[model samples]
Target: MLSDDELLRYSRQILVQQIDVEGQLRLKQSRALIIGLGGLGSPVALYLAAAGVGELHLADFDTVDLTNLQRQIAHDTQSIGQSKVDSAMARLAAINPQIHLRAHRSALDADSLAAAVAAVDLVLDCSDNFATREAVNAACVAEGKPLVSGAAIRLEGQLSVFDPRRADSPCYHCLYGHGSEAELTCSEAGVVGPLVGLVGSLQALEALKLLAGFGEPLVGRLLLVDALGSRFRELRVKRDPACSVCGSAHG
Candidate 1:
């Protein structure tokens, strides 16, 4: 049940036809896990919190650096040396004091990751690097949870959603083979600040739609953004029958 304060606090969003009282209540009951607190994770965390997700578990092993301020909006000069999860938590708490925030200051191992995935309604893969992305996909597949993955590097950004519970949905490993080893870093490649913000904000939007049972979630499609060219494209993604992570043989 939403408190009178909650109803009033979220009155503006609730006024929308798609998210009236019922959707607002669902938002207040959803639990989401965020796998990173950097560029993409920053806006994802903030919007989810402000939109009234009941519980948010933030996981990140990195600390804020002076360079992060350019794209990581949740951290500021005062939080320069603080842990990313801690810095993000502080900002989220300030945004909506009613929501629950859990901080996981380190990367999760296989067993711990499985446990964390099992505990959440959905998982957001905002982490950088292929290794972590693969690990997150494996855990979500094993636990049959939906995974929202977003990445931004240089002037390019991509977003996708994979629901392991849906047999037809493609997991991240299906789109990018398990053997692929390409790894890119923003520090080395240099990402525009707004690029990540745009992707992260869209990530939050996908999450809200999924949670509230509203518009279509990007279950088997990937959206690509070319910030330099100022254009967007969509690709139809298919599940690989040979996918090692979510294949019949794996099951």
Candidate 2:
């Protein structure tokens, strides 16, 4: 049941034809886990918080640095020395004091990651490195949770969703495999600030669709954003039967 205040606060979203009172109620009952507090995580966290997700588990071990302000909009110059999780939590709380926000300032190991994913209704892979992304994906696959993954670098961004609970959805490992690649950091590769915003916003949209049960999500498709070319492209992704994370072999 929505309180009068709740209905008033979420009135605009509830007024939408697809989301009405029912969808708003769903948003108020959902929980989300967002890994990383960098550029991609910033908008993902902000939008999810504003959308009234019941709880948000934010995990990020890094501290805010001056270099991050360009794209990491959740942090400001005052947050330079603070933990990313703390900084994001403050911003999210200010957005909706009614929502619950949990901050995990330390790194999450495999066991902890699995536990976190299992507890949440959905997971957002806003992480930068392949190691964290792989670990997050594995946890989601093992727990049968939906994973919304986004990445941005050098004016390009990509977003995809993998629901291990879905029979045909592809896990991240199925697409990138466990192969090693040189790490790409925004500091080195130079990502446009708006590129991260665009990708993260798309991730939030996909998550909302999944949680609210409205539109079709980007379940088996990867949406690519080329900010430089000002174009968008999508690729259909299929689960690999040999995928170590969510394959028949794993079963």
Candidate 3:
């Protein structure tokens, strides 16, 4: 049941034909886990909280630094040096006290990750590292949970979802083939801040659609954005029978 305050807060979304009251209820009862607390994860966390996801489990081991001010919208000058989860939690709590926010101050390893994955209905892979992305993918596949993944670096961005609960959904590895061995940080190569916002906003949109059951999630297709060229390309992606994560499970 939505409180008087909830109905007032989410009225705009509820007014949509597809969402209405039932969709808002679904959002208020769902649990979502988001990995990473950087650029991509920042907006994903903020919007989901404001949208009233019942519970949000956020994971990130890093601390807020000066360089992140440009793109990591969840953190501000006041939050410098604090744990990313600590900073992000404060913001989300302020947005909608009706929503529950769980903050983890440290990174999750393969050993303890299963417990986190076990607690959520869906997972968002906003982690920028190769190893963590693979770990999150495996956990989602193992648990039959849907995943929304996005990335933005320089002037390029891409969004895709690996919904193993769907019969023909494609996993992350199927689109990227294999994780990159080269590591490039914004500190090194630099990035255009708004690029993260564009990609992160799209990620939030896809997540909302998945939660509300209103529109298509990016399960078997990938959208690549070339901000510099001012172009958008949609690539058709197919499940890899050899994909170790979704191969044997075969949803």
Candidate 4:
């Protein structure tokens, strides 16, 4: 049951046949945990908040440094020295103060990470390091939660979603092998700001689709954006039977 103010707030989305009132209500009941409040996480948090996700659990141990201001649109110069979660909460609150905001100023460990993923309906892996990504993926797979993963380096970005609840979906380790290659992240490689925004927004879209139960979510497709070369390609990804995360029986 939508209140008068709720109807007005979500009128645009409700007008869409795919969404209507039901989808809007689903959005209001969704709880999303977003790890890493950096470039890729910025747009994801902003859009999800604006879309009215009932609760947001933001985890990031980093502070709002000057280097992050370029693409981390959720933070400003004033946010410097502030916890990333604090900065994100302020921005998300401004977007939709009606929602619940849970700010975690500390990094997520194994136990806390499990709790966060299990509590949320979905999780977003916005961390740059492969370690954090793997941790988030493992938690998602263990909890049978949908996970949205995105990344941007230099002028390239990639987006994918893995919902263990969906049998055909593949986890992150399925797409990217669990290798020990050193990652070239934005801080070291210098990313084009818009590229991060583009991919992060895509991550947000897939997350919203899953939350609202509308349209086909990006279950097993990897959408890549090569802004430098101005090329876009869709890569097919299949789950690994040997994947330790969501494989047949996790061995």
Encode model 3's per-residue lDDT on 41-89: one tens digit a residue. Answer: 9999999999988999999999999999999999999999999999999
After superposing candidate 2, which stretches have Cα over 4 Å from the reference?
A: 249-251
Writing each residue's lDDT as its tens digit, candidate 4 over 15-79 gives 99998999999999889999988888999999999888899999999999998998999999999
Error of 3 at 58 (Å): 0.8
Which of the two, 3 or 4, has more lDDT?
4
Clashes of 2: 0
Instruction: List where candidate 4 sits over 4 angstroms from the true fold.
Output: 249-251
Tell how far residue 142 is off in model 2, in angstroms. Answer: 0.6
TM-score of candidate 1 relative to the true fold? 0.97
Which ten contiguous residues of candidate 2 have the minimum total lDDT?
A: 242-251
Residue lDDT tens for model 1, 1-251: 99999999999999999999999999889999999999999999999999999999999999999999998998999999999988998899999999999878877999989999999999999988899999999999988889999999999999999998787899999998854555768888899999999999999999999888899899999999999999999999999988888887235
- In terms of lDDT, which candidate is stronger, 2 or 3? 2
lDDT of candidates 1 onward, in order: 0.92, 0.91, 0.88, 0.89
| Residue pairs in clash, model 3 | none
Off by over 4 Å in 3: none
TM-score of each: 0.97, 0.97, 0.97, 0.96
